[model samples]
Target: MLIFGAAVARDRAWDVAVELAERVGAPVWAAPASERAPFPEDHPLYVGGLPFATGPLAERLRGHDLAVIIGAPVFRYYPYVAGPYLPDGLRLLHITDDPAEAARAPVGDSLVSSAGVAMQMLVGALRRDRREPEALTPQEHRMAPHPPTDATAADAVMSARQLFATLRSACEADTVLVEESPSNLADLHAEWPITEPDSFYTFASGGLGWNLPASVGIALAESDSGRRRAVVAIIGDGSFQYSVQSIWTAAQHGLDILFVVPRNGEYAILKAFAELEDTPGVPGLDIPGIDFVALATAYGCHGVRASTPAEVAAEVAAARDRSGPTLLEVAINAAVPSLL
Candidate 1:
């Protein structure tokens, strides 16, 4: 099995990774909390992302006897979930550029080198006599289903899953997706397909306030390079407020970026953490009545509110023709996702 992490994409080693995987016909998993996706989500060998805790990860890797992890540590974990780091009879080979990361890992033998160079060398060294793994079974490329329109008034709002499905349908295949909506991330990952290298980004630290500015910089880089891939940042309302001022820079520079805000009117991520930590009754978690449209307009961006599925799709499609930055605040149903 092959496991990928951020540095693989950072080093632009995805082509070599694809070659290696195809040569070996290995099953691949995106490491948990990976900031950059190193492999195409549509690849047949691709399974999905791994869980971010020890017990859950071990259980996921139970059937695999050998794991080859590239461009990351043996594993990056959170919440101190207690369990064995690796299942019995499983061995890991870790390849990373950072020697410190290799040394710090509790499991796995390490190889320190540039990701691209190392993968190329591995591809050259593999014996020609090795048999390719059996072909992957065909699977349908279906996204999450849309919400039923005939629901009760209480269930009238668009769900996070529906919002992501709309985004997946509206966004271009080459669009660069920068994500920071923590609570709804699982839904986005489930719905959106990262089909190309360098097409997705996120904060590995899992902190707030970086995504907005970082997206502006990404748009700037695209301008400088003249590659001009569409930059789309999906941010939560609460986190958007942290560095909302960055939109001004995008506006001033005339960067063509689309900022999609899923407004649930609360710090939904914090609420999820509160539940996980068994700490309820958390005060100041609800942040309602923030006019994101006015705030975006004040920053000199084209602002619009999308409350329905059709409006969301139309706004996203309309954003492609915008000359400067556009902020589409989508009012979605409130739901705290499980952290694990």
Candidate 2:
């Protein structure tokens, strides 16, 4: 089976894979990239990472009777070469957090729900069936070494670990986290442990500039229920540029939302890729100094700039006290290694 999504969805997908494999007594294939660590690599049922081309992946699944995909995108990219992974009449089941993703993927059956809830339901059903145990083999336990940490403290104002811990501590149980900084999510996921279901975490459809707007949607949902759950959006500076207008909506609605901007003044992910390819720097990647706080103020939302951990903590606390929208601009060192 195949599953894909953001970090939070990836974790839910893994849970679903584990339960399904055990119930059907079949091996499970996980394709989370090396960047997403702490996954159950020790499991023997793991088939290995998914290949880049569909031909190879389909060839590997030649005799499989069913294909289950979660979280992962089906139309991520195209390479032209194609073959049916499932034989004629084989069943295909897909689960995804995004309804759009579920609707877009080629599938016979699909479930549209948060990945966490869908996984819990699937596992609960399997447990009711009292399936036999199908554990991983010893050989499959061997996995690639962990990715090296190449980020320097000077590159980022605060490490992803530090930022998550601070936020986790400052927020209440009902808080919702909307994440669009895809490049930093690996580190964020590894550092944060999600134990509650209400703490909704969302990622874009492998697309940029959805973070701020998505957070607004989540906040509006919470407001409709008359719940006091705080909505927090951790967005990259580059991503925030895409839907900056959302701030005005949040202010107009008086939504209790906080926008955390991890500013590095450049598309750090693209720069890293370019460096790896030994290519000259690309144009329009660098974002010169922009006062995000001022932009937020222009939208009638409270704003603050944080350059240190203490300042971040203080600003977060202040935003939490406010009853309306606020923006916290964090000047992170752009030199940090890409968690991808």
Candidate 3:
């Protein structure tokens, strides 16, 4: 099985990955840190992102005897929890550019090289030996277009699930997402499966407010290339406030970026963490009276407010088609989500 990671996605090595997978009949897996899926999730031999914890990951990889890691670390974990690193009896072979990652991994034999080049050589050797890998039966894609009814509007306001489904339906196929709203990622993963390379991005550093600035930089680069791909930065109000100044830079450059701010009036992710840790809800988590629309207009970018589904779709189209930057402040339910 192949584990595709951020380096692979950033390096644009999906073509070689597909060739290697096809030749070896190997199942491909994506990591959560991966910007977008290198291998199409619809492929029969393609697996979803790995589980969050060590125990859960071992269970998920139980059936696979061999794990070939490509362009990613052996594992990137969080939560500071301790457990078994890998399943017993499973051998790992890594091919990556970073020797540090290979050396630090608990268990793995690594080949230091360009992942694309290594895969090409491996495919050539396999062909020379006339080795025929197992062919998997293709299966129909299982993702549903919309989430459950209860998952949509919470407290009669647009929910996280609703926002993602609406964006998925409204945006162009090549549109890419730069995500920072951690509380809503579960909804994105559920409704919006990564079908294309470089279509989705998120910071795995667990740091807040970084993606907003990064999104602006990505917009500038994409605009410079003259690609028609829409760049949407779907961020939380808390995250947006941290780097609100970036909007000025985006507007100054006339970047064609669509900033979608889900206004829940508080740090919902932190609330979830408080519940998980059995600690009291911290003060100063609630944010109010921040006029994002006014801020956007002052910065010379267009802004809109959308509370209904139809209104949101219209705003999405406007943001995507506009020549300059635009911000859509969507009022959403202030419901606390489960800790990731």
Candidate 4:
């Protein structure tokens, strides 16, 4: 199996990674928490992102005898899950541009080189192997979409799955997605298929307060380059507060960026961590009474609220035709996900 990281796309080697995967007849898994789409998610060889912990990642790659990891750390983990990094007898070769990334890995043989150069060299040196590409039959390889929820109730809040499915259907194929909603990561990844290069971006280190401002910059660049692809940012309510002032910049400059805030009235990601760590009854996890639409209006951007799928579709369509940035806050169910 082959694995790719953010640097593979960052260094403009997406095509090379795809070519190399095709040459080796291996399926590709984007490294855990990868910020960019190194390989097209629509490709047959693409198996989606890996798990974020040691044991789960190893178990996910169980049948693979040798794994070639490119342009990423050997592994990036969270919650301090204790287990072996790789399964017994499974060999790994880590290739990356940063020496620090190569040095700190707990397992695997490391090589430091430019991601594009190393992959190009490998493409020339390695012949296409005869091994039949293995089938990815289990749920770990790709997350199946959740069944669509009924959005008919007068005051019912949509689940994250429903919201993502609605957005996926409404969004354009070439739309650039800037995502920072950690709690909704699984649903969003399963629903939204990123088919084009440079169309999806997130913070590799999972930092807060970066994506909102970064979306502004991306929209500005899009306008200047004459490629006016719609830029939509999916930010959690907790993360939206970290750099809420940045929306003012987007408004002042008239950048056409759409900020979709999933208002669940809590820090869902932190709650998930607390559960994983067995530290329950944590105080101050629920955050209530924050008016995101009002805050957007205060920042001089158009603001609205959507509670159902139809409303969400209408609001997104209207935002696209608007001249400036808009913020659409959607009410979503507050189900905390198991992050393993």
Q: Which regions of candidate 2 are displaced past 4 Å? A: 1-67, 70-75, 78-149, 201-203, 273-278, 336-340
The top-ranked prediction according to TM-score is 4
lDDT of 1 by residue, 180-240 (tens): 9887776787678787888888888577888889999999999999999999999999999
The C-alpha stretches of model 4 lying farther than 4 A from their native spots are 128-131, 138-155
Worst 10 residues of 3 by lDDT: 139-148
lDDT of 4: 0.84
Worst lDDT 10-window in candidate 4: 144-153
- The better candidate by lDDT, 1 or 2, is 1
Task: Give a tens-digit lDDT track for model 4, residues 163-237.
Answer: 888998998888999998887777777778777889988887668889989999999999999999999999999
lDDT of 4 at 42: 74
Best by lDDT: 4
In model 4, which residue pairs have backbone atoms overlapping below 3 Å?
A: none
Q: In lDDT terms, how accurate is model 3? A: 0.75
Q: Estimate every model's Cα lDDT from 0 to 1.
A: 0.83, 0.63, 0.75, 0.84
Q: Local error of candidate 2 at 194, Å? A: 3.6
lDDT of each residue in 1-340, candidate 3, tens digit only? 7787777676787777777887777767775445445676676677567645566667657877898888877776644345677778788888888989878877779888887778778877776433355665422221211122244575659887788789889988888888888767667666666778877777764678789999988887787888757898998998888888999999999988999998889887788678757776688889988889998999898989998878889998887668899999998877776543
